[model samples]
Target: MNYDRILAARTSRIKASAIRELLKLAANPDLISLGGGLPSPESFPLDLVMELTEKVINKYGSAALQYDTTEGFTPLRKALVEYINAKGIDAGLENIYITSGSQGFLDAIGKLLITPGDYVAVEGPTYLAALQAFNAYEVHYAQMQVDKEGVIPESMEEIIQSYPVKFVYTVPTFQNPSGKTIGVQRREKIAEIILKHDVLLIEDDPYSALRYKGEELPTIKSMAPDNVIYASTFSKIFAPGLRIGFFVAPEKLGRWLVLIKQGVDLNTCTFTQALATEYLTGGYVSKQVQKNINLYRPKLETMLKELEDNFPKDFKWCEPDGGMFLWVEGPEGMDMEKVYKRAIEKGVGFVPGTFFFPNPGDGIETMRLNFTNIAEEQIKQAIKILASVVEEEMKITSIN
Candidate 1:
């Protein structure tokens, strides 16, 4: 059918996701997968879901099933006001807008702001799906340096100074792939830099509510209200299948985002939005968050302990306070992709870290491991198996 000949030029910039392909290997029931950023089935309030649905049906009636405004369902937006305000974000209904999921906002924002050859400043090893979203618009990336604290404010300033970047994107709170939280001072510095440069920043925070051991950090959005667009999802705290995510941006930008979303999907989902409205307004969030923490904290601790006991001395990983992943870095010249293949063959799977970087050839010495989805004992088994693969790779690297 030679469809390639008729396809748009922009399609060439998009590549198949390496993590998605690797997950296929993880589908084998015997494989202990530390690959996907999936929440534990136990974390879902499945018993509460039916009750919530019934409440939605009773409360909103026909409107719950009917089409809604491009912006979002009104009651859900209203309910989120008190919800986000607690996090220190001063947002009103005008500031909040919904999308199919956070992924939808990522794609819409890319479509809204990006022109071909436009540069976006991102951390060296940033969220893989973000790069995938921006790539379709043929966007270029200006890589920013990161340490254990997530994005360095100075590196961000340097990138902004060096490149004609359209915008800056960051997953500042318990960031994906890296599980590093930017501290309050760094958040202030980042806010200062963005405001000084008069640039927009996207704060992709999907994991802040899953706190395990640290004090809650202030959001970058609160630190720089006018300069940052804050986006989050119900995937972690609630359920992923609902596909309900929302953003708080300046009213002007929010309006445009809604307009842009109109062409994509008329609205996120009326019934789901109704369900979210009830969930948020019914005081279910905190209890659910605590339940998730109780379920995941031990698994995270188990994985950390297993790594300390089993992994090679030179290998290190971020001990995050709360998040779904841990970023493990092997010594220099160690390629984690080779380790991933070996681990998969041994019935353990993880994502090779290079896939997370916007630039090719970066983060080859690393991999990302997920603890929430796997049982504690399985996490123990997977880490032990994965460590052996890593040790073997280290020995091979030493010899070669």
Candidate 2:
């Protein structure tokens, strides 16, 4: 059919997500996956959700089922305003917008802001889906440094000065895959840098509500609301299947986002928005968050302890304050893709670090392991198997 000839050139920039691809392989019943950043099934308030679903359908009926505004269900927006405000961010309904999921916000931002070949400064090991989104817009990338504390503000500032960066994107709090948070002081400094450069910032924060330790820090949005376009979702706190997400932006940008969303999906699901409004207003989110912490924290600790007990002396990973993942760095030149293959042969699955890099061929020595989805026993088994794979690779490297 010569479909290539008819397709848009923009399509070339998009590729199947590495995690989604791995998830397909993880479908095997025997496979224990430390790959997807999935919430523990135990964390979902299933009974409560069933109740909410019935209530929404019964109370709202056709309104819950019918089409609504692109700006989202008003009750949900107002609830979000009160929610983030409790954490020190000042948001009004005018500042809010909703979408299919946080992933939608990424694509919409890419659509609204990215010009083909323009630069988007990102963490060296950033969220893969975000890179995928901006990539579809044919955006170039300036990779910045990251350590245990997430993005290094100095490195970000250097990239902004050196490149023609149109915007800066970060997953600051309990970041995906890496599971690191930018501390309050660094966040303040980073916000200052963004303001200085007059570049827009995208704070993709879906994990902050699942805190396992330490006091909660102020959001970058709170520090620099004018410059930061905040994106978060109900997927972690509630359920992923329903797929509702929220954003906070300046009025002009917020209006444009709503308008842009109108052309895309008209609005996020009314049923889910109604459910979310009830969930938030009913104070289910707070109680569910504590339940999630109780469920996930022990699994996180198990993985950390197993890594400490079984991994090679040179292999490194840090304990994140809270989140689903632990970023592991093997010796330089270690091909984690090879390790991933070996681990999978033993019925363990995880994401090789290369998939997250801004630059091709970077992150050969790393991998990201997710603990929340896997049971504690399975996490222990996966860690032991993965460690053995790393050791085997090290031995092979030594022989060569």
Candidate 3:
């Protein structure tokens, strides 16, 4: 039972994510959690999945249940090739590699490319899990600035040019925590910078299909195919439980990814891949995505309206066109760590923003609120409680 002594040096180098630690508190039924960026279970197409499962059994039978290639089930790869090409990216089955989820793809990339002390550029408040994945490999990270339009181009250029970055990591569409999309022009600029400087780019795009308002922007991969590694997931569109995701890498890089995957899981679930192949080829995915958008748009609108009405005027927050979360920043000098503790005691919860940053203490005044998981009334009440906590915290800080 002496686990501490047995743990490896790599394990000792990493700490548990602060947001994940907070999520454990959300288990209490009394808690109104705006914490985790979780999709609503109501949005999942359970009936369609049941139908798809039956179809998979009827069509593939024993083949669906058998082991698959590390490169993924062939039909699924073919379907994804067509899907990405339809989105205007020139892709083929050869460029695609399927994994358990987009998170798995991240891990594979870390395993293939990262060496200890290799510099990685990321949006200042990036996805915490990506940082965790890279950190496990002992990679160093440099933060890029993000504005309303997402990662700032000039900041990205500065970092890319200055650091010998292994790859520039980005969540171009509806970025996690911030909920901001990188504009089309900025996307082009990013591509140009990466191509000109010969730095690799990793585009993590899971929320592109969930857009409720903005015009679709071309992925960075489309702009500079040779330099960008594109990643997407079925979790946001179809179902997270399926654990299916795919990545598009240049031929050489993709070969390495496939080998890394073989060592990791041998392959993703054979049955699930067969089911997803049917779902995509049968035209169910588009409809499901639209259904998700329709369900979440009103919830997002309600949360934004409530925040405007309830929170103090000085508090700034992002009004994301689409995505599961909104980033809220309290007035200068107000620490979100303290605010989060107070809000939890009052029966509401949110992820404090510092957890998303590669460097802690940088986003101390902020928090990320998820609108997709809770009902409208719960959102209203949670925001009201959060507003009260903000006021109380501001008062306490002012007195000090």
On lDDT, the leading prediction is 1
Model 2, residue 72: distance off in Å is: 0.4
In candidate 3, position 145 carries an lDDT of 90
lDDT of 3 at 133: 88
- Name the 10 consecutive residues with the lowest summed lDDT in model 1: 15-24
Q: In order, what lDDT does every prediction score?
A: 0.91, 0.89, 0.90
Runs off by more than 4 Å, candidate 3? none
Question: How would you encode candidate 2's per-residue C-alpha lDDT over 1-400 as one tens digit per residue?
Answer: 9977998888887755555775566677888888887888877788998999898988898999899999999989999999978978888999988889899999999989989999999997899989988888999999999878889999999999999998999999878778889998999999999999888999999999888999998999999989999999999999888899899999999888877788889989999999999999999888898898999999999999999999999888978888888999887779988888788888999898888998888988889999999788998888999888889988987823
- Of 1 and 2, the candidate ahead on lDDT is 1
Measured against the true structure, the TM-scores of the candidates, in listed sequence, are: 0.98, 0.97, 0.98
- Candidate 2 achieves a global lDDT of 0.89
Q: For candidate 3, what is the lDDT?
A: 0.90
Candidate 1 lDDT tens digits, 1-400? 9978998899888756666786677777888889888999888888899999998888889999999999999999999988899999999999999899899999999999999999999987888889999999999999999998988899999999999999999998888999998999999999999999999999999999998997998998998899999999999999999999999999999999988899999999999999999999999999999999999999999999999999888888999999899999988899888888888889998899998998888999999999999899899889888888887887888834
Once fitted onto the true fold, the runs of candidate 1 whose alpha carbons sit more than 4 angstroms away are 17-23
Which lDDT tens digits does candidate 3 get at residues 109-139? 9989898889999998998889888888988
lDDT of 1 at 152: 88
Superposition error at 329 for model 3 (Å) = 1.0
Sort by TM-score, top down from the best:
1, 3, 2
**Pairing residues by index, what is the TM-score of model 3?**
0.98
Using lDDT, rank the candidates from best to worst.
Answer: 1, 3, 2
